[model samples]
Target chain A: MKSEDLETVRMVVHARSGVAVDISKEYAIESRLAPLARRDSFADVGELVQAIRARRDEGLMWSVTEALIQGETCFFRDREPFALFRDDMLPALAARADRPVRVWSAACSTGQEPYSLAMIVDEVAPRFPGLKVELFASDLSERRLEKAQSGLYTQFEVQRGLPIRLLVRHFEKVEEVWRLSQSLRQMVRFRRINLLADLRALGQYDVIFCRNVISSLDPALRGRVLEQMAQALAPGGWLVLGQDERPMGLTEALESISGWDGAFGRNPAFRAAA
Target chain B: MKTCLVVDDSRVIRKVARRILEELGFEVAEAADGMEAMAWCRTAMPEAILLDWNMPLMDGLEFLRQLRKEPDGDQPIVVFCTVENDLEHIALALESGADEYIMKPFDGDILSVKLMEAGVLA
Candidate 1:
């Protein structure tokens, strides 16, 4: 692929979605777009790039962008985060008594993280009797959101990180696939959301999981997203970022909690009451 | 250390169970059949037994019956771990002196809860 076509692809993806694709990853673009080109009956990658450059193919552009952003995720992908949330976070939140706890699983790929949160909340909520826990999951892709909303997973998907006990208790086997129990499905509300967009409409959350997403964006966009996440969290709320990402150069509204790499507590000085 | 005897024909199942049970602070043992499990118990009975429903040499039901006749056999917490989920099968296991029953493909959290309920772990 020529430099011009690569630039065109990058511009369209960035303009439509906040995803930053590196020009060095021209091969990645080619591999991802080749199938789209074939399906759309384009002559070649250059032709597809030209079609995207033409500016009228909003549908094609969106499809290409969405394809690039859909990430591979699994239930309880990292055991440490879920363990910290259950053993430490939930119990601490239960003591507050100010309101029922609200959790947000940002960039939830296919509903696993949110469902995992739901299962933990289900176990802990009974202890707090009156506490009304709300689990909200969001992603940038509508296609992924549709799959997430269904709460169905393949055998391989469940096998990734899901414990067999949780599988047997919370999910029912539907032929070869596993369907999340209705009660668990109802625990989460899925929505189409871009981190670069306004998050006020999603409301403030007591715990926000914005993991493994910022590393994909450029440094500037990463900062902006972190700032927005800080704003979206309630006063004294927690923000959990990906292990590799941090708010050091991005935002100062969140202060890292001791002993956990990805966990942050909202700085009361910067947080306005929600 | 509290000891647990895992009886199953499959080495994979035994390994998985051993990993989970060990994490919960149990000294784990393995037996491929009921007869082998009985022989181990005669030497020194485990604090808990994770019994598999089906196996060669002797099945779980016969093993449980023979186990109950031994001194201090009734003291061990016996949990039947298998793929059998029917009411008839569960009833048969319970009647044969199984203290608890759980399906295969189990996870550590559920295993912990089951063990807690069985008074095998504090």
Candidate 2:
């Protein structure tokens, strides 16, 4: 937790993942890395940092970064965004549908957001029969992606935001735990991709949910990430951010729509004028 | 407090549904099967019923059919809770007088939404 070690950890983390760690969060680094150091046969966090500095192991560095990254999430974490998606966004997209709708849940830690989206799409599928929907979810951590792929959740995990109706409908009880139905599981394709890296390979999306991610990055990285997300959208596609996050001065391609809480549409006028 | 009857053959599901319904502010009663559920209905009608599709003695559709003819039976909003996913069975349940349908392995949010949509919970 020394200043120099903190700086090194920060440099390595930001260099690889673009996540900014404040000096005040040195305690968090110590706490998260202490056990990792112990498991790796090191005496303490300092030793872990020393090893990383000495060897510069890419896998070990990634482990440190992933451990430092917080994956706090829940199914339908907030009601408002989902309500907006159900009431406004889906219908608008339905109207403009010429092909299957592609949705990406960026930074989709443990897969709740995209799975929640799949449930909504399933519930509304009867209304728009034959409207094929393809879902893709991505995260920076391979560990979290593995958990997401398993589709298993503990009792306490399911208790958060997941309603009993959905729990019973889309999930099967696995002994003491719950597992998402295979049908729901297959709806999402999970991948490990850092938001700071080239996202064009993921292809354009009709709707993107990049919530609670940009706010954690440094301001400069935040602007770059926002522009990348905007560029990933289809011509008039939607990009949803964490409820309190915004697009002000980050990108000209996106315009915050009036009366929409956390939703932004691609700026057709700006594209037209250009 | 509003009361709801949870009718399912499985005690585990009854307990799970009971916990969620109580959390949503509804007083809950349980019946192991359709016959027992109908008996409970005869004594005191619940405001809503989370009925299972398959059960001993009488199934959910049978209970729905018989309950609609009984006095005060039409009062309880019925939602079919089951693992059956076939569209044909769902249509049959709707035709037999189900207010709503929710698949098995549900949690609090899905239940709350379905109940809210069914006008069972405010």
Candidate 3:
């Protein structure tokens, strides 16, 4: 792909999905789309881009967008954050409010985050007895969201991060692949959400994990996206960011906690503004 | 028989490690998360712990930090078994008092070798 064409696709992806693609990673982008390009009988990504610009093929455009978005997710992507959520966050949230615990995995990209959250809640649910916990998972890509809803993972995806017991308990192995049980699959409600857009309609959440998805936006867009996130977070609710991502300038309502990467709201006033 | 505590939130991982440890002749105990692991530590007093980095309640790092504060800080050989494959993350785990670091999707042989090196297995 030419540098100009790569730049154009990057801009379009960012504008539509809020996913930032580095200019240096043009080859990766081209390789990802090469199959689609060939399927459409285009010689290369350059021709594909030309075809997309003609606005004659909506299907090709969707395919290109899907190709650009990295939906590479595995169960329990990072172990520590989930650990924190299970040990520190969940109990804290349970104690702070008498209502049902609500969690939103924003940009949940293929459902790993929410499904992982559900597994944690499932493990602890017996202890809580009557406490209700609802998990909501959303992504900008409808294609990804549909895959998330299916709760099916290939052997490779199943192998990473998932423990053997969970594989046996929550999933059934069909040949080499694994499919999540209905019980676990039903725990999360998957939806299509544009994080850069208004999120107030989604309602409040006790914990929001918008990890790794926001770093691609411009700083102003990042701030606006976070503000929309802040609107959905309940007071004392936790926001988990990517390892290198910072929420410092994102929202004033959140105060950085000692150990976790991002901040927590000590006061519940932030969501009240929603 | 020697005893080892496998402290991880993932049941699949715990089971795999337990099988490997048990095959190597160590009796294995398990905890679903760090808090449960801490509770087990108070009573079980296992000779070693195979910890996972990310968990729901208290993560392995926080658990290690808290465990090190106890009076019996040096009681167990704490080895972090996790998917945080970055070298810097491994260094951080060691700096946090983890006796050894094992990355995830690990081979059973590698696990056994690490256990032997840590003296949890012969």
Best by DockQ: 1
Off by over 4 Å in 1: A271-274, B1-122
User: What are the lDDT figures for the candidates, one per model?
Assistant: 0.83, 0.85, 0.78
Instruction: Provide the RMSD of all predictions against the true structure, rounded to 1 decimal.
Output: 6.2, 6.3, 12.2
lDDT by residue (B19-117, candidate 1, tens digit) is 999999999999999999999999999999999988999999999999999999888899888977544676788778886777667778657766765
**Candidate closer to the true structure by lDDT (higher is better), 1 or 3:** 1
lDDT of 1 by residue, A1-274 (tens): 9999988878878876677888798788899889989999999989988988776588988888887774878777666788888888888787885777889999998889999999988878778776678898998888888999898887557655665456666877677677999999998988888888877777788899988888888667877788788888877688998767788877777789998767897776775345
Candidate 2: CAPRI quality band: incorrect
Question: A56-127, model 2: which lDDT tens digit per residue?
Answer: 999889888988887999888776788787788888888888898899999999998989999999888899
Worst 10 residues of 1 chain A by lDDT: A159-168
Clashing pairs in 1: A165-B107
Error of 1 at A138 (Å): 1.0
Candidate 3 deviant stretches above 4 angstroms: A56-59, A261-263, A266-274, B1-122
Model 3 C-alpha lDDT per residue in residues B1-122, reported as the tens digit of each score: 87889988878888889898888888899998899999988776788899999999899999999888877967888888897655457667777888776767776766765665465665
Q: What digit string (tens of lDDT, one per residue) describes model 3 on residues A80-129? A: 68888888888777676588899899888888889988999998877767
> How many steric clashes between backbone atoms does each model show?
1, 16, 20
Winner on TM-score between 2 and 3 is 2
- Model 3, residue A23: C-alpha shift (Å): 2.1
